[model samples]
Target: MVIRSRRLSKDNTYYALKQKIIDSELEPNQAVNEENLAALLGVSRTPLREAIQRLENEDFLVRQPNGRLRVASVTIKEVEEVFLIRSMLEGYIARSAAKHATDKDILHLTTMMERIKHSFQLGDKQDFVSYGFEFHDYLSEISELRTFEKVLNQLRDHSLRYCRYVSMHGDWNTQADEEHNYILQMIADKNEDGAEKAMRDHILSSLSTALARIKGMEENEIDHIGP
Candidate 1:
């Protein structure tokens, strides 16, 4: 099983690097030194290159003018484009979830929502984002649409850094909490149309906030995204 072990190692390395990018530890447009990253991750060049290649295919890393790799930067146009598609996908998922979700699912989401609300009040944006994702993940899971779930997960991961960035700049937490509560209510009431509409509205609202943040940022100022 040596080969299998190596495959697992490569996958682990890939996800670790991807998470670093997503969390902005490796900031947008920041240079990537292969040797340094290999040393830091404690992996050899071969596996590191393999992981890097995968990230390149995913657009997480891009070749720069100086022929070095850097984390991909965000754009207002891309944010709007991604969120528009997300609105449609998540709206469909909410519709299906409202028709299929059980009491257990509802209760779990409600509890998670309460935790999210509490975290928001404490100004813990990180935990708030985490719980917010968990809430959406649960709804996606209950929808039982594997293809839709997979695509939505990828889209969410791509947009999460931007989402967190804009969220930290304003009172998005309070507004998002209210919107989430309304969505949850729609799901609980089994109002498929309402659930769909609520989910789309919520995503569109976040997109509005993200677009504002993107507009305010200077191209060189993206690295300073966090509070």
Candidate 2:
């Protein structure tokens, strides 16, 4: 369980824990005991503590009043805050990408958008969701803004669990695909203003739809982990 970290990337332990948290391999609301996790990851407590602190700063995990770390969870408020921030950042990224993206980048995004649609046709929710994640990164890369990409990457892993839950139970992939088409066209046309508005609308609409679905599922209890 050696955690071999390369010098090229950011903190290795933080990312490892982040991925595990995002993948749901580490359960939500589950307590992380430092000594155990340190042993498990084959790292000393110092680096593990450093990693946990980073996650704590990011709001991915929180220290309870009782003084232990757990995957952070809150009511619908978290959904609102995260989605609002997402709308802003996504709108900016889309607009910037329209201004900066190359033809090749647009083509790549188009290909990914098509892949998302095809994935839905195949009823592969996992794939549709995963490709959606990639599409976002592609857009961020094209925006030529490392800050936005960094912010997005931080939000995305946590968002994946929520998106997966929504896609699995929400039954609105087709609508999502339609929204993707709108965004793609806006970017392709290099309409920065239009792309920004469209992206903001899409983010709000998606959030609304997901919340509605979650509300409908109130009869049956489900854990909604939001970014």
Candidate 3:
């Protein structure tokens, strides 16, 4: 019973800290003060340490040369790599979904896409993002590829972090709505090749938008810092 309780505590601590990092509440490259973090999270030191170690292993936290922990900073290289990999993996998933999806699955996906469209019309970026993920998640499920789904789940979380950063910039909603509709159409038509291509193109397009926004942000920061 005691061991089970401790395990639960550790799991809870890990998820709590992970959520903070994902939501940017911790912020990129922010220094972590272990004692203060424990107090802030209301967790004991042991479970907190365990959670920190887990997050570090996941690349959400980094240990500095001086042995201090900090949230990992987002980098263009990481973003490019992550989205490129996602394009490949999710492209394959989209193909699989095309090959396997039922009429019922198509109806569900169409309904979800309607919600996404409504969110876009309402200028509700948050709900648009949420419904968009639901659409992709359903594809992952219908793909029936357990291993691919597992890997994509982790990549999706990383993508979420970047999406949150750049989602407000540019004509993200317009581009996303069009791309998502195209992808959905390809899947509904059972065009496996087209679905794969559409999915890959969508992800790579997202990468382009993210890179542009990040570069613009960096340039603005440089401008602010210069004399």
Which numbered prediction scores highest in lDDT against the true structure? 3
lDDT score of residue 150 within candidate 2: 88
* Local distance difference test scores for all models: 0.87, 0.79, 0.89
Residue 78 in model 1: shift from native, Å?
Answer: 1.3
Error of 2 at 190 (Å): 2.5
On the 0 to 100 scale, the lDDT of residue 115 in model 2 is 96
Per-candidate total of colliding backbone pairs:
0, 0, 0
Q: Write the per-residue lDDT of candidate 3 for residues 7-61, one digit (tens) a residue.
A: 9999999999988887778888899878989998999999999999998888999
Residues 1-227, candidate 1: write the lDDT tens digits. Answer: 99999999999899999888888778778888899899878888888999999999988899777789988887787789889998999999999999999999999999999999999899888778889888988999999989999998778878887776666565564788899999999999999999999999999998887887777776436657745
Q: After superposition, how far is residue 89 of candidate 2 from its true place, in Å?
A: 2.5
- At residue 9, candidate 1 shows an lDDT of 90
Tens-place lDDT digits, model 2, residues 3-90: 4443212376777877777655576677888987777677777777878888899777889999988876533666666778889999
Model 2, residue pairs in steric clash: none
Residue 53 accuracy (lDDT) in model 1: 93
Query: Which scores higher on TM-score, 1 or 2?
Result: 1
